[model samples]
Target: MNRTDDISNLFSRFGASADSYLEFGSQFDYKEKPLALVPATPAPEPVVDIAKPVIKHCDTPLAEAATDRVPASSPVHASQSTAPLRHLLAEVARARQAEAQARNEEALRQALPHGRPAKTRAHVIALISAKGGVGKSTLASALATALRLEGGQTLAIDLDPQNALQHHLGAEPDVAGMGNASLNGENWKPLLLAGSAGSLLLPYGAMSEDERRTLERYLDNDRYWLAGQLANMGLGENDVVILDTPPGRTAYLDQALMVADQVLVVATADAACFVTLDQTERLLSERVAMGQAPLCSYVINQFDSARQFCRDMHEVFKRRLGSSLIGVVALDHAIGEALAYGQNPLLEAMSSPACQDMLLLSDTLKTQLKSMDVAESYAS
Candidate 1:
C-alpha cells in the first residue's frame, strides 16, 4: 500500500479532497481497485518510402500571349492554380483559432469570483532571535493578541520545540510534541489556541524524521504547503497570520522570515543581545530591505529604567536601533502573573503597568495592520 492507494480509498470513501495533502509525499493502501488496467502490446514503427518531387508548370499561356489581358476579364484558371495563395489561407485560419482560444480563456477567468479566504485576516509574522530564551515567543504572542483585538483574524504559530509559548498563553498546548501526534496523517491538525477576540491559534507540535522532512518544504513557498493547505481551509478570513520561531538561524527560520508580513527582532538591553541583533540585522537584510519589511519593530523585554545600568543600556539601544525601535516593554511581574493564569494581560488586569504598555503597543500594531490592508488593495 502506498500514497496513491490511500488517495484512491479516500476518493472512494469520501468525494471531498483530503483535508490536507503533503507538499512532499503521502501513504496509501492498494487492496481496493476502482478498475483493472489492461496491458497493451507495443506498436511497430512505420517505414517511409522514398519519393521524387514532381514539379508542374502552370497551364497558363506564355508571357507574350496573356500580356494584353484586361483586369475584369482575367482568366479564372490562373487564379485557381496559385498554390502559394492556398497555403497562405491555411496559415490565416490557424492564427484565428489560436486567437479565439486565448480570448475565451481570459473571459473565463474574468467570470470566476474569488472568495475571502479563511486565512485572509491571518497574516504571517515571524519573530527572530539569535539565541534561546530571549523572550521572542513572549513578544510574538503578545503582538498576536494585540492584532486580533484590533479586529483582525489571527493565528499564532509557535514553531519552537519547547513550546515555551504555552506558559505565556496560559493554556497547555494541544500538541504535546511529535511523539504524541503524527502529522504524516490527515488527522494531525495544528492545535488551535482559543481567545476572546478575532484571533485563533495553531501550536506547532513535534515532528518525526519523516514528518519533519515533509513539513520542511512548506516552510517556504510551493515546496511546502502548510500556508496554502491552511489557506485552502478558508482560514484566510482573518487578515494576518503570525509566527513565532525558535532560536538562532536555520533554513526553516529563513523560510518563515521570507513569508513574514513583518519581523520583530527581540533582544535584552545587554551587550550579548546586541550581538544577536547584529546577526539578526544581517539575516533580515538578505530577506527584506530597509523599511520594506512593512513593519519592523524592536522589543526589549524586561526593560527597567530605575537601575542606572538598565537605563544606560536603554539609551544605547535607542541610539542604535532608532526608528526601528517600535516600543519598549518594562519589566513587570503582572505579565508573568497573567501567564500563570492562562490569560492575555489585556484581559487579566487592565490597570497593570505591563497591560498599559501592551495596550499602547497593540494600538500601534493595529495601525500597521490596517495600513497593510490598504497596501494589499493597491498592489492588487
Candidate 2:
C-alpha cells in the first residue's frame, strides 16, 4: 500500500475516526485550505496571579511552571532606579558646600574692609570696673547709642551674668542673650537685639548654675575662645564693639582685655569707688608693662559738682589720668529717669548734661581711632 494510505489505515486502527481522516484528506486537495494542527480537546492552562511572588500548587514541575508563567510587563533595572537618588544626593552635598563657602567669604569680607589685611582687627572698646553699682552699664549703653547716632556701627555686649545691660538698652527684661547661645553652641547672629539709633545689643541670657559653670570652664580653658567668637562677627573698620563686663576680676574681664583695643575704666566719685582704683590700676599695670594691654582710659560717672569730695576726686582723676581722663559724666536725675522709663538717655535726653557728656566721650573715642588709623597708615 501507498505511505499516505498506510498512515490513514494506522490512524483508523489507533481509534482515529473515519470523518477525521476524510477532513484531513480534504485539506490536501489543491483548492482547499490547510487544517489547523491543534487538538480538539486540550487541557486548560494553570492560571497565575502575577501580583504575588510565589506560584500556586499545580501538577507541573516547578521549573516547567516557572517557564510557563508570564513575566512583568516592564522589568526594573537596578541602575536606572538608583541613578536619580545618587544624583539628588550629589546635588545636596554641592549645595551645602556652596553655602559654607559663601559664609566664609562673607565673614572674611566683613573682617577686612577697604581691602585691608586681616592683621588690622576691629577696634574693641571695653568698659570695666572693680565694683558694681557705679552706673557702668548705663554709661556703656549710652556711649554705644551715641556712637551709633554718629553713624558708627556699634555692638553692645553685656558680659555680666546679672543680665542687667538689656534694661538700659531698652530691651525686654526677659530677653535671651549671649550666655544661652554659648551654652547651646549656637551662632550669635540670631540673638542680637535692636537698640536705640541702629545699635545692636547682646544680653547675658539667664542660665542655670550648671550651664554657667560649663561656660566658665569653656572660657577658662581657652583664653582666645571669646576673642575667636567675636572675630567671626564680621565687624568692619568703623564698627565699634562695647563690652560691659561684670565688676571685679572675672573671667569675662580677662577675655575682654585679651581683645580690647581700648579699655575704659568706669569709676564714680564715691569713696568706695576711689579706693578700688588703686587695685584696678595695679591689675592693669602688669598688662601695660607686658605691652599686651590696650590703651587705657578712665571715665568718672555720677559726679556731683556740688559735693566737695566729688570735686576733689574729679580734680585728682584729671591730674592722675591727664589726657586719659576722657570725660566726667555729671550725675543727673534725668539719666536714672530715662533708664527707669525704658528709654535711651542719648535719644530721650540729648540735651541733658549726662547725654552731652556721653556724646563728647563718643567724639573722643572717634578721634582716638582716627589718630590710630593715621598712625597705622604711616607705619605701613
Candidate 3:
C-alpha cells in the first residue's frame, strides 16, 4: 500500500534479497511466499500450451498485482513475461556489489598509515592570484623557504605550466619533473629535487604542446587529481605542501583548492588588485561552502611606505581585509636581486624590510597552523 509494501512486492516477485532491499532504507521485514498454484483440470473446446507457465493478471497496477491473491474464478493465462524482470534484478545486484567494493577500498585507504603519528596530516597551502606578474611564484618560493627555515619539513609544488618555480628553488631548467613523470605514467616521488632552501621541489617540467594539453585535460576531468598525487608521495603529518598555482582562474586552481588546507590570495597595492578583491572572495567562498579551506587570507605584497599612494592602499587593505590581512611585505630591491642569484631573499638579506616582514608572516602562519585542529581537517 506504501513504498515499503511496493519494495516488498517487487522483491518477493523477483526473489530478490530482502537484506539488499533493506539497505535502501526500508524498515519493514519481508519474506517471500511461493505463488499459489492452480489445480489441474480439463479444458475443452480450445487447445492450450501446457508447457508455458501460468500468469495471473489483474487491472491493478503491475507493482500491486503481485501483492494480491488471485481469485479461483479468474482465468489463468500462459505467458513468458518475467525474463526482463530477472535481468533487471541481476543488474541491481551487480550495482550493489560494485558499491560495496568501492566502500571497502575507501576504508582501506583511510586505515593505511601516512608515515605520521595519529591525528596528523600534511598541511597544504595554495598560493593564487587574480592576474599575473604580481610575484605569486616568488612569494611561494620564499614562503616555502621560510617554513623550512623554521625547522619544518616542506614540499613546494609548481602547478603553473610556465615552470618558473624551479628556477627560484635553484633547480636547473632542463631537469625532468612532475610533468615528465606524469606523461610517462611513472612515479613523481622520485622526481623531487632537493631545493636549495632545505625543502623539496616538484616542478611542472618541460613538455610539448600536446603533452600540456593532455595534462590539462586530465586536471579538468578529475577535480581531486592533485590530492591523489600528493597522497602517493608518503608525506608525514609534519610536512607542509605549498602549491604555486598559475595566475587567474584555471583547471589547476580548481584542483589546488580541492585539497588545500589554507588559501593565500596574493595581491599588490594598486587599483587593479583592489577591483579583483570581491571576485577573489567569491571564488574562495565557493570552496569554503563545499567544506574546503577554513582559512582564506590575503597578503599585500610589494608594499612601499615611501609612496603616499602605496601607504594609502595598504591602509585601505588593512581596513577592508581586517584580520584576514595576514602580512604586508615591504617593497625591496633585494627580492629581485636574490631571485637573480637563485637564492631566497629571507636567507640572502635577513635585515631587509621584506625579509623581516616575511619572517613575521611565517611566524604568524606557524602559530595559526598549530592552533588549528589537525584532526578535524584530515579525519576519516
Predicted candidate 1, C-alpha RMSD: 37.0
Q: lDDT of model 3 at residue 37?
A: 100
lDDT tens readout by residue for model 3, 73-163: 7755546534577898999999999999788567645644343222225888899999888888878887787774234588899999999
**Against the true structure, candidate 2 has what lDDT?**
0.80
Model 3 has an lDDT value of: 0.80
Model 1 weakest lDDT span, ten residues long:
217-226
Q: Per-residue lDDT tens digits of candidate 1, residues 302-339?
A: 78777888888888999998988887778887777767
Superposed Cα deviation of residue 190, candidate 3 (Å): 1.4
Candidate 2 lDDT over residue span 1-380, tens digit each: 88778877888898885456543335463667779798588889977788976634679987977877757666778877666877899999999999997885676445332421232256788999999888899888987787642444788998899888888888766777788887666677677899766678999988889888868866766666567667667667877888999999999998888788889999998778778878988988878886776888898998899999889988877777788888888889998888778877787555798788888888898788788779879999
As for TM-score, the candidate ahead, 1 or 3, is 3
**Reference-based lDDT, each prediction:** 0.64, 0.80, 0.80
Q: What is the lDDT of residue 82 in candidate 2?
A: 67
Residue-level error in angstroms, candidate 3, position 154: 0.3
- Residue 174 of model 3 has an lDDT of 72
Error of 3 at 85 (Å): 52
* C-alpha TM-score for every candidate: 0.59, 0.66, 0.66
